[model samples]
Target: MIGKLGQTSRRYRDDARSATSRRLVIGATGVLTALLTVIQIAAMPAGPTPVRHPLAQGSVWDSVYTAAQAARGEATFRKTCAACHGDSLKGIDDAPPLTGTEFHKSWDGNSLSAIFTKINNDMPSDNPGTLSKPQVAEVVAFILQYNAYPAGKADLAASADSLGGIKFLPKP
Candidate 1:
């Protein structure tokens, strides 16, 4: 009877340990599943979603810059760019034309931000990045006008985000 009692006690202890181990495994799995669910939710895109501007379908024919801005840009171009790009912007020696095939083909289907950035950071050859943001924007407006792009109601803002929203398109 004593030996039987001891065996029964040992068996009960073993059963209790197994049940505890099973409970632990279940609890760990629950925690892991919950963590993964949170991660997935966190990774998903949220509200007020970012706007990615699409490429223009036709050309700069659709009004983009303002006439006043273009006029201001023309003045800036004459003062800073005419010496190198020429009065007609037809390129002088190594200076590339700013209104013809090369300019349009290179910028077509791309964002205006590219042109803004290039001119804002590197221009005039002798002096780089000396032009203020607004000046650069004005110069860009003039170039668009020279390319035969129509003027809009508002002036182009000197901002990368705003410029990035405008795409260049091939002429129709």
Candidate 2:
């Protein structure tokens, strides 16, 4: 009986060693294959890159500031700004609305620059100024639409200096 038990123990140890060796072989093969694949990828040729303006800090308003832009802006606002401003752009429980008499009260006498600064500096509730200037302008256009303002031929300026020159006109 003792002889039989000693043989069983030896077999078990041999099996364990063989299993460990097999696992190491598989692991090494996998690492080598991965290394080869990465080398192949790095050897591939690169593609040409597109050109972009240096000071393109954000979006620049162009002649494209149309009804379509306003509509598009509205969609962006609804998805990103609606939670805080409500669907109507009126402030939510703790948030302020984007339009109406209350909105006018907060910004009517202010210049477009002031409005832009407020939005660019402190908007979107969760992530302010994170949006590009073009996105911010689109949002402004949507707010204007809600307040019954007319669309202009050009998009609002995208640059801070240009934005400062714009004045927020009170809706008639």
Which is the leading candidate under lDDT?
1
The CA lDDT at 1 in model 1 is 100
TM-score of each predicted structure versus truth: 0.64, 0.58
lDDT of 1 by residue, 135-162 (tens): 9999999999998887878788897677
What RMSD value applies to candidate 2?
A: 18.8
- Once fitted onto the true fold, the runs of candidate 1 whose alpha carbons sit more than 4 angstroms away are 1-59
- Worst 10-residue lDDT window for candidate 1 reads 50-59
Global local distance difference test of model 2: 0.71
lDDT of 2 by residue, 101-133 (tens): 777777755656676667788887698878888
